[model samples]
Target: MPYSNIILDMKGICKTFPGVVALSNVDFQLKKGEIHTLMGENGAGKSTLIKVLTGVYQIDDGEIVLNGKEIRITSTGEAQKYGISTVYQEVNLCPNLTVAENIYIGREPMKNHSIDWETINKNAEKLLDLRLNLKIDVKKLLSSYSVAIQQLVAIARAVDISKGILILDEPTSSLDSNEVKELFKAMRKLKDEGMSIVFVTHFLDQVYEISDRITVLRNGKFIGTYEAKKLLRIDLISKMVGKEFNNIESIIKKSRDISFKASEVNFVKATKFGKRGTIEPFDIDIKQGEILGFAGLLGSGRTEVAKLIFGIDKADHGTIKIRSKEYSYIYPLKAIKEGFGFCPEDRKVQGIIGELSIRENIILALQSSMGIFKYLPMKKQEEISEKYVELLKIVTPSIEQRIDNLSGGNQQKVILARWLATNPQLLILDEPTRGIDVGAKSEVMKLVAKLASAGMTIIFISSELQEMVRCCDRIFVLRDRMIIRELIGDEIQEKNIMETIAQGGISYGKN
Candidate 1:
């Protein structure tokens, strides 16, 4: 096949923050009518590069060429004028406004020097019609629609400007399989029309499904770009993480096996714990020295279940029992006091306090659990920090080091350390190993097993089926806001989990 025409090119791009090289001598090119995927672990400079390209950040070094001409993008407005637009993971639209208004907020059609609602709606519908496969009411308020629809509206808006490059950053993270298929169809249609798309995501399956070419970045450096069809999934992961993906089963199998010893103690039990239109009420039980895995597809209510259990979101109808005592409307603070700790999925937003030091972050949960007036002694704080620094193998110059300065793996470890310092009897980890390197991933899994073996009950969520099968003593399969199946003992296998998820219902059997 003939090489595609180059649409966008960057040469020797470099960006740096205080004491950190975010991107170093990175080169990238996008071809017309092709979906180019940017692959990397978190903090591998993927976000930095995207920000630089979209004028969110000024590149310290590099030249950008668009359509065979050099261009300098100084601001978001300027970038948009030069035919470049970005749709971030979070939908950047006014929730209270109508879909049509959100799509053409500042660029609405005018009639007699006034906003023209009819013309605006017509134009917005045209754009949506050209891009998306489904029909959306242009007059409906954005918040009334589901997340998938809102995401589609965002993409429709981004592509409406006509001659620009569109960048989609992790757009499918929250979308279900059917929604993802719809998004892919739209993307392929856009590619066929000569639009250059830069797709950024952590889902390996998606990269292979939609990308024409794949570009790998590791620790701020460009590894190489290859045709998507020629790249194996394992090879792609190895390149992005700069190491071979470990055999999770082998690692877990080699570790000392801990038999399940039933006890009268029930760490957590929730009956009908769910919010309307969010997650269905589900009952779960965890015993000491057990790692209970929540297995599900995207938007299958795994995170929602964890959130309800952790009190991040209040359950509208349900009863939760901790150690045989019922909790009525328990919040996070109350949960913490009851020896419950939660590590959220989105680490950057919910997990880390970027402004705090490693010691401060580690001590946060403990401090809260201890109450505000009860300050932790400095010596005690140091002792606790040092212990977890060794236990979780957190890498830092000192406990005094700023949490933001550490690498992604180390930062994740620090988050884990934060909860561990709380001395929780039951810990809930939501996508704990996401966006980290292979070595760090294995370390985190081993830490989880260790914690369980020491009689700390744990509930973990992972999108990787193999991980759930390996690390969890029992797996609860969720689909569309309900637990459909529970696999225990020898039934907890990768094939079983995948088949259950594919079948899209609940099944249960005791070992």
Candidate 2:
């Protein structure tokens, strides 16, 4: 609570990219022996602040004080030298190597000019079991354990390497409830031992549960820092987004002018659609002007179903009909030509082309549908990009700026603009709101609802069950690559969806 107890203090921090001010005179302070969480929406400079502190990026102008002394960290090695270590969401470890080797890697103990196998295994096991309460055979391969376990192993290694300060970035994003509890337990143990931790996560519940202090940042500026218990969740969200929280009802009010109901006409229909080793054969008829959702955990065939429907992955067997026209063969180009657009789950890998300008990225799908023979002129491309930028509220300095210069939320909007340019009858959005901040998520969901109400059919897939409940008109529950049940009307609530997934009940004779 007082500067007297602060172990790490960053003052007047400033980091700038080509056309973006990532962090502008931002300030962050971490108390000794406490868990401090950095909070913000996408592009709010959370990652940039962390990178500057961890030596991934040297600060253009700032002063970093560690242990009451000024320090300049120019590399990861220097950060570690200053007793700062990080464990990212994706565990950066070798799956082929044994846990012991991974923990001590690069600094393994030696015996008579050879590696000391027994001491390494013994110490790794003792450190994990005694320090973190994680009991596992250190001789086993890293891949033998689940993601949760691998995360704990990473923490164990980080603590062993440098326990003064540890940074956990979205560690519980992929873990189950039980695994998250175990992680919290370990974090508490570390904090009790006088280790200060810097946590960065999008999940509010986890932040409030583990953090002693919460720091809010917006538009590359320091908002404030308050004790976790003293900060209300709503107030914290407001600070992060730089606005009061608006409920889903307020977002949908914009589309209230249009009727929000499923029409009798079928937009897309699949009879016994099946993909080998991906998803089971299932019959589905997506009605016009309806939001059909695929709800399930990660790797529950949600993306697979989207892929099959969008012709990204060919269906091994099925009869597909689009607007009552039967199609014996399907592919991406054909799907596009037939008035279908898809926003893929991984925007970085499958969606956005980083080096391309915002204007070029937005016109890609439309140009593809028009074919190279009918290439759009530069003026048309600029007009289309500017139109969507205004329509979708995309924040950009210029349309000619590279898409990579924009933030995560803006990048997602560019992808959505690409699809909207095609004027598709149906849009397949797979995790469209994933990885973005809550504010961006609200914008995307509002856009989805608006489009559906305007007579566009949507097939949505998301891991966030609450999002599916709030946005979907009907939800098809899947488990283990099989369609388990269909939920509609009053049945499309979060509790019911969870129960359905847990019970794995057969519905429509599909499972």
Candidate 3:
């Protein structure tokens, strides 16, 4: 229970929107000097509970006790005054300013009615270098530092403002393996200093690495809390997703078993297609009605290649051939007109129109392809949205609901629907299942298999090795912004991919 030295206790927390009961009688407790992780699926009320605790959303019913005293935090300032602070996934500090200036931007030390620049720089340097064991020059612009260092600076500022409690929401989503290690070190140091941390993330491996206690929530209800060491990974997954681990695997296997046959014709033939400083020149041929995968580590040019192919960034070298027609260069509108659709990796920023409704979002690509003058009627839009909403099992009450109101899984479904509506010949999906739950991931994979079986050419890119192995007919192993090796059906195993990534590439002799 980790209750001997309780710092924050939330009981009977309930919150609801117009048609959604976001949180219902949820309970959470935090022990002093410990790292507690909040685990759940996209619609499982993890964010609602954090909002309730941080005063971003007023609870419908509940009580929050901090330091054995009941308190109400009406706003972000009030929460900070009560010794609670939060750092979100994106670094919120100004990159143009010096690291020290960002650390004490609004609240600066004053001497003789002037800002104490020297003292500020020294304290900032000491706090990061000594207190957190992070070595960085505080005088340098924050933009010069990596994302990991910027995140630590944001944490330093939060700790200085509110030292009692810290909430980190998806803090390591953008970080690589090494960067994650650095962040974990800082987290451990803070825990040793008697700070209570509420970590909200989807990366299970990271959760096990840094969490002292784990609290599971599902569908706006409190499941249970357990010591990290005592809770098995499978059990935690089951609790968070309400599915047996074996059953989840079966679902993926079922989709993987769907028979796929490669076509003889090359739907896309790229000859040394690349952009300098992005992805090195590479030649490849994508067959009709097959799923070709691109596997690599973070910053391995997976997204860069996709961007170059889709005309988001025009390639500086080589040529592209679609349906036996050669082209020297292409752009977005031209690609759309040529029956190409792309779903970006970062769905929130690059894919969905948050404020728009599901119907509007679904028709975006189709509308763009048809030209601005060829407006789709409201009735036709409704038909398209309703058809996909049912087909994808989107789980939304109505198509008029804002896309932002839907869960991550449903939002992803809508984005897929947007591409499907255009009936494109070739589709590119980048990390389609990221940041979603296990169930949603399985469903998305199944949908991909179904599409491929129906004679659609697709390019699938994912960081999860198992996913790439399951859905891709052939994979291109990339490293250092170059395609190093290609794995056919039998060779596309997770171990093989890992080995190739570790040892640069597999030896296939001279092709």
Candidate 4:
């Protein structure tokens, strides 16, 4: 297990923004031919470290050594020149273009002043067959294949172009179990052939499965590095969160005190609510002033149910009633009109408008819900933004500043503030604390509990079993787009929820 060579070494790295010190004196080491994992909670500087190495950011301090020599990467092209390539979660490729064109688009060979289609396709096919062992028509449009295939094509593109380091940033976020295996297969193939890989993901199972080493960071500071086999999973999580990993019972017991079961007239009732070909028909009643949680695997239909409720996806069947207001089909506008607010899973894509100011974004939901003509005064907007900014402790220079400049945690708080401004009867939060620090997650969960106590209904969704057990009064167990079980009372525990998800299937009638 001795590492013969250190292919890349980052020493005393530091990165900072206006109010946030992203990384401080952090050191990362990547061994030649070894798959190294950058482990931490969201905002743990995992992405920052990768960015500094990949020329996405100019380092404030420290040095980068590659292949026993110093190197300065100023841009993506320069990073590629040093044989450092990256494939982010969202593949930076055109779906409308052919697979071959996507693979060699910028680096295509010119034949008589035109792109040589024959050479591009032939080389792409060779790379797919030889290295990835993939058998597919390179001439086909990239969108014709699944996300997993596109992920592989992305990796194939990187592998064909670079020889030094390949960074995969949460590449399996959208892939199913089978697709993840295929990705791991390709990663293993690369590792065996002496390609150093930097993998950043929140999934623990994938960590032990694919990584040779893991470097832990906390609050933008390097904690330690350990071999994959040497570190225990619980200990690793503890290090990342900067807390002990033995408080499940205490957390659940605390959740029990904030109860809504004493008096419930059913806040919202869905009768056979379903989206055809998306989620199966199901019935459930969410109580007033209660935290309802959805528990499942990556594609176990957790997000789908939230979408159906928030009207992001229209339901083909069933009826929904919010506080006795009935609707045959629920969509976002109707849901919002009838007192519903949604914080989507993908914060970057769907939640916040980056170009807008904090003041503008905060009043968006309320403004939209009140109709466009019911304009909020500029003074009123500043007052609301300033109030929530202080309440949620959003780190921003001023309310008029653009939202894109803030950190992930601050941005999440802004979205929460936006929804709270609407004062909706029910809130649906999907992965509300996915990529933030442990402190921010605690704050968000506490806020959810406080809001529910203040008579706001919440449907919480998260992949963390511990968080689900700790926050939810009742959990709906989903699998394959169906609510298999509605867990309450003693069934709401980490062990039970996991077991229910792994051992049970969708077999119950509409509940």
Candidate 5:
């Protein structure tokens, strides 16, 4: 490849924040008409590098060359002027605004020095048609559309700017398979027209599907860049994780085969668990010692299912029975009192207490369960913290260390410890291993198995099919807000789960 054809280049980029070197001597290049993917475990400096390139952060040491010209980009506007735009995972457009208004917010087409609504809508429609494969109504309010449509609208707006590079940061996180296919088509169209694209995502399959080349980052350093087609999935994973992927499958199978006699007691039983317009009613049973897995594609209601069980949202039509007593409309406090613990999906937003010390965070759920005024004695609190710190192997200098100061993996462990300390009979873990490293993920999975073995009922939710297959004795597959299938015994495998998700029907076990 000719280096002269590079449209964007960063050399020896170094960024630091307080105690962390976010990025160190990283070099990245993007060529015109190519989709260059940035891949790494979360907090591997992918976001930091993007921030540096997009003018969100000024690099301490490095040079950025756009179109062979070295220029200073002190703000987002300056970066946009050089033809760089970013669309984050969350759609940042104003939801209340019309699609047309969102598309042309700052640079509206004007008529007679006044806002030109008609021409703006017409122009917005035209611009969208050029980039998007779907027909969207420009006059519709953004909130009226689904997440996939809103995301496409965001991309359409970015395409209208006609600039140097476009960065798509986890654009398909909430999109379904069909929606992802549509977005990929739009990306290809833009690439054909000579747009340099920087794609950031955790989904490995997507990286291979859409990218021309891949750049791997690990722990704030650039590992390597290679042609997408030339790299194997296992090799890519190994690079991202900094080790040979462990034989998680064998371990899980062994754990599953170590069968326990079915207990007469049910820890959690829901007759038709669901909320109207959110999740479809489905029956679920968690025995005293079992790890039940929830598996599905994005927007498949797996997380919604967890929410209903945890009482994050009220179920419109369902009866939950814990220890043979039926309860009506369970709430968070009630769920906790009834021996339930939940570790929500988004760790930063829902799981961690960033401002609190690790010990305090670890004891949050237990404290809530034991009533706020009934604080644990200092000695007992220290003992609880010490036990879990060693149990989960959380990497903190001390239990008193602020949870925010820990790495992503350690922070996740702290959250897990919080729930574990509650001593709940049923633990609900939603995407427990998300954004963590391989070693940490393995550790967490092993812990789940151990907990189940120790008679703690568990419900594990993950977007990764292989993880679900390896971790649970039974798996529930959901699609479009409904439970499509359930897999148990020997049927729990990656291929079967993917097929069930694709077909939207139960093949392995009865509903």
Candidate 6:
């Protein structure tokens, strides 16, 4: 409704890579003077579609129409020349440089045969003031500024290409409420000035607030586009996942079952586990061959519980028992010695050692458990890593290959292999399937099933209720740092989980 003119149009786009179909016959359109939102789940082909549009990738088929003319953007620079610019989720600006220097790094003003510092700072300040209503010391190092300010700086740089189409990808992921409001204000300003923008984000509230139109993608295919006001959030979610919300009954019945009786709790037991401000005192028990799930929204104390259980964070109260032996305070080393393995939520930051080889990372945690003196010989290390790589179906050229060079799913498998090498009695995986493709997710689920069937106790945590219902034998629903609801057998359904989350863990009756 903002404008009748179409600024950009991507039609019947088809893109593919080895072992993956990123985008297939997808169509996306953006109107002038409107903020269009691209919505999808992880591995929904949002990033691939964006890459194809921005010239980060060359399309295998279909055509792109920009301002009523067919255009093929082969590189980032060429995309910019065609009035298309992108500010990615991660700010790509140099942190050590000044705000002004970062904005105009490669394109600095030259005055009187010298670098024009005065002109650069002045121009940067002017741009920020006019576009984003931001007042900052442009001379200061960009690192000194907060992430919110840096996001604004990135936008200021992108919007400098006047009348251009700016693509903002998950810019609000790390921002607080006030910062997000300020960002929305800046976006509105850009919209008012007749600029077209493609906004990609996972936040539904933000999408409804800022987007004039919504486009949904699912499994490398375009679903449909609708005006923001007309499309309900529930419908959008169903479209993104290719299933209705009410049809989640299928998730409750899984293909795998616990090989050992799940009625007993012998593996790990938390008696009023509390970490003060971190997580409330709660009791949870798991059996040797049981898969327990923790489900909650962001900041709902899911990760906090995992940290407390894994000894990453010291418990302020309560006792943890492993195989009927109580430990009042279990430190990281002690947990490792006690046969506990933890795969952190953030794989890139906490799990993978980017510079190290797959073999090195796989054996690092196991080596720590054995102590420095119990060194694994190079040949033995290769065998251990090779065994897991093949067992886990990790696609790598060799065990010596750098873990960072592999895809996200492969890196996740490496993390799993690392934990598995220790032969831990209990494995705690927090959001293990995040940021991986659907194929990898399936593989990880299968692996979890296999492990549980092998009599290993596993704690699974995920934001996706469907996944929790599918894989977990029993689910503990947490809210505001407390165990509010526990679902078992017939109660363990996606609908039940959603009702608990929405209604403060009260039973909504059987579906």
User: What tens digits encode model 2's per-residue C-alpha lDDT throughout 183-281?
Assistant: 999999988878889998765557778889999888799999899999876577556644442432222123323456779988888988877656777
Full-model lDDT, candidate 6? 0.85
Candidate 3 achieves a global lDDT of 0.85
**Error at 202, model 4, angstroms:** 2.0
lDDT of 6 by residue, 1-511 (tens): 5678997889999998997888999999888998999987666888999888888999999999989999998998888899888999899999999999999988899989999999999999999999889999999999999998999999999888645699999898667667889999999999998888899876556788899999988879999999999987656756765656656665555847634556475778888778755677888777777889998655567888889888899998888998768987688888888888999999999999999999999999999988999898998999999999999899988898999999999999999999999998789999999989899999999899888888788899986777888888889887546677888888887767655654565421112
In candidate 5, which residue ranges exceed 4 Å CA deviation? 1-4, 245-287, 290-331, 344-348, 352-422, 428-454, 458-511
State the TM-score for model 1.
0.69
Query: In model 3, how large is the Cα lDDT of residue 188?
Result: 87
lDDT of 5 by residue, 350-422 (tens): 9888899998998888888889789888788889999999999988789999999998899999999998898
**Local distance difference test, each candidate:** 0.83, 0.85, 0.85, 0.85, 0.82, 0.85
Worst 10 residues of 1 by lDDT: 247-256
Clashes of 1: 3
- Could you give the candidate ranking by TM-score, starting with the highest? 6, 4, 5, 1, 3, 2
Model 3 CA deviation exceeding 4 Å by range: 1-3, 245-287, 290-338, 343-422, 428-454, 458-511
- Collision count for each candidate, in order: 3, 0, 0, 0, 2, 0
Query: Which of the numbered candidates is closest to the native, going by highest TM-score?
Result: 6
Better of 1 and 6 by TM-score: 6
lDDT of 5 at 234: 59
Candidate 4 segments exceeding 4 Å error: 1-4, 110-115, 246-262, 269-285, 293-308, 313-329, 343-367, 370-423, 429-454, 460-511
Question: What TM-score do all the candidates reach, one by one?
Answer: 0.69, 0.66, 0.67, 0.74, 0.70, 0.77
Instruction: Give candidate 2 misplaced runs (Cα > 4 Å).
Output: 1-4, 245-287, 290-340, 344-348, 353-423, 428-454, 458-511
Please report, as a residue range, the 10-residue window in candidate 3 with the lowest summed lDDT. Answer: 245-254
